[model samples]
Structures are given as structure tokens and as C-alpha cells.
Target: QKEVEQDPGPLSVPEGAIVSLNCTYSNSAFQYFMWYRQYSRKGPELLMYTYSSGNKEDGRFTAQVDKSSKYISLFIRDSQPSDSATYLCALELSGGGADGLTFGKGTHLIIQP
Candidate 1:
């Protein structure tokens, strides 16, 4: 199985609704988790990052990690049309050589007016 697994959701919601996305991993050695937002044909922009087991919040975005369950989540509040994009979950293993982060197949999200 892949180290990280996320539903490639074509998730749709009305503007102003709260959106929740999730990912799960099998590697216990993964200590760093990140959520990235990507616009079509554009590079991903980091939205949130967390280390180990804890919660991190920024503006309308929040990230959570649970080492015990090897699960992670991202919550987006007050969804807007501008927030329509692909969301990707990434993991960095503690001693992961130069291989860099392993990313999930991105979930596509759309906020409608």
C-alpha cells in the first residue's frame, strides 16, 4: 500500500460552507505532514504544516495529525470560489533520504456560488 492515502474527492460545496479533507498513512516514521493547494496547471502552495501529533491552525485552515492512528486532516472554513482547487496531503518520513515527501493523489474541490 502507498504510504499515504487520500480520497481524490471531486468534492463540491456551496460558498461559505465548511470543508473537510482527510488523509491516512501507514508509516509510523513520518513526522512531518503538510497540506498543499494547487491551482490548475500551477505549482502547489503550502497551506498548512504540522509535526508529529498535534494541531496547527492558520486563518481559515486547520491541520491535525495523529501518530497513533497515522491519520491527518485538513479543515477549511468559510469556503469560497477562490478556494476551488486540488488539495494534496504529503508526508515526510523521519529518516527519509533524499527521496523527499510522498504525496497523495490530490483531491479536487469546488466551491460554488
Candidate 2:
């Protein structure tokens, strides 16, 4: 099974709704988690990052990690049409050396106006 699993949700929601995205992983060695947002035809940019188990929030975005359950989540508050994009979850393994992050297949989201 893939180390990380995320629903590639073509999730649609009305504007101003709260949107939630999730990812789960089987690797206990992963200590860092990140969420990236990618707009159509553009590269992803990091939206949130957390180390180990905890919650981090920035503006309308929030990220949570649970090492015990090997699960992570991203919540977008007040969803907007400008928020339509692909969201990716990434993990950083312990002692990974120079290896880059392992990313989940992106979940596409659309916010209706």
C-alpha cells in the first residue's frame, strides 16, 4: 500500500462554506507534515506545515496532525471561488537525508460562487 493515502476529492462546495481535506499515512517514521495548494496551471505553494503532532492555523487555513492515528487534515474556512485548486499532503520522513517530501495525489476542490 502507498505510504500515504489521500482522497483525490473533486470536492465541490458553495462559497463561504468550510472545506475539509484529509490524508492518512502508514509510516510512523514521518515527523513532518505539510499542505500545499496548487492553482490550475501553476505549481503548488506551501499552505501549512506542522511538526509531529499538533495544530497550526493561518488565516482561513488550519492543519492538524495526529501521530498516533497517522492521520492529518486541512481545514479551509470561508471557502471562496479563489480557493478552487488542488490540495496535496506531504510527509517528511525521519533521517530522510536529502530526499524530498513524499506527496499524496492531489485532491481537487472547487468553490461555487
Candidate 3:
């Protein structure tokens, strides 16, 4: 199994739908969970960062991590076309520092106008 994996979802939804994106990791040593938003050819911007298990909410986005299950998730409420972007889930290496990131394939999300 891959260290980290996510479905590359082209999940299309109406303007006001709630969206959910997810990822799973095989390494329990992973401590940092992050979500990134990428628009087309542009590089991804960090969306969520959390250590261990918990839920963090920012604006219309909510991020959840379950260390026990080695899973992570992002939820978007009241979605908009402007929110359309690819979501990537990642895990920071256990020891950290310059080891680079392990990223999922990313999910393409489209919010209809």
C-alpha cells in the first residue's frame, strides 16, 4: 500500500453543496496532517495543518484527523464556485525538516455557479 493515498475526485456539486475530501495514510509515525488547495497548474497552498487527532475549523472549511485510523478529512460547507480547486492530503515525515512531503494524487472539486 502507498504511504499516503487519496481519490482523485472530480467531484462536481451545486453552488451551495457541502463538500467532503479525504485521505488515508499507512504510516502511524506520521504526526503532521495537512491539506492543500491547488488550482490547475498553480502550486498548492496549505489549507489545514493539525497534529494528532482533532478537528479544526476555519471559515467554511473544517479539517479532521483520526490518528487511530490514520485518516484525515476536509469538509467544506456552503461551497462556492470560487472554492473550486484540487484538494491534496499530505503527511509530514516523522522526524521533520527538509525531508519533503508525501502527497496524495489530489481530488478535483468543481462548484457550479
Number of the top candidate by lDDT?
2
Worst 10 residues of 2 by lDDT: 91-100
Q: Compared with the true structure, what per-residue lDDT tens digits does model 2 show for residues 1-113?
A: 99999999899999999999999999898888999999989989999988868889999999999999999999999999999999999999854455589999989999999
Candidate 2 is scored at a TM of 0.94
- Overall lDDT per candidate, in order of appearance: 0.91, 0.93, 0.91
Off by over 4 Å in 2: 95-97
Question: How many residue pairs clash in each candidate at the backbone level?
Answer: 0, 0, 0
Q: lDDT score, residue 26, model 1? A: 87
Clashing residue pairs in candidate 2 (N, C-alpha, C atoms within 3 angstroms)? none
User: Clashes in model 1: which pairs?
Assistant: none
Global fold similarity of model 3 (TM-score): 0.94
C-alpha lDDT (0 to 100) for residue 38 of candidate 1: 99
What TM-score goes with each of the models? Answer: 0.94, 0.94, 0.94
lDDT of 3 at 26: 93
Question: Which residue runs does candidate 3 get wrong by more than 4 Å?
Answer: none
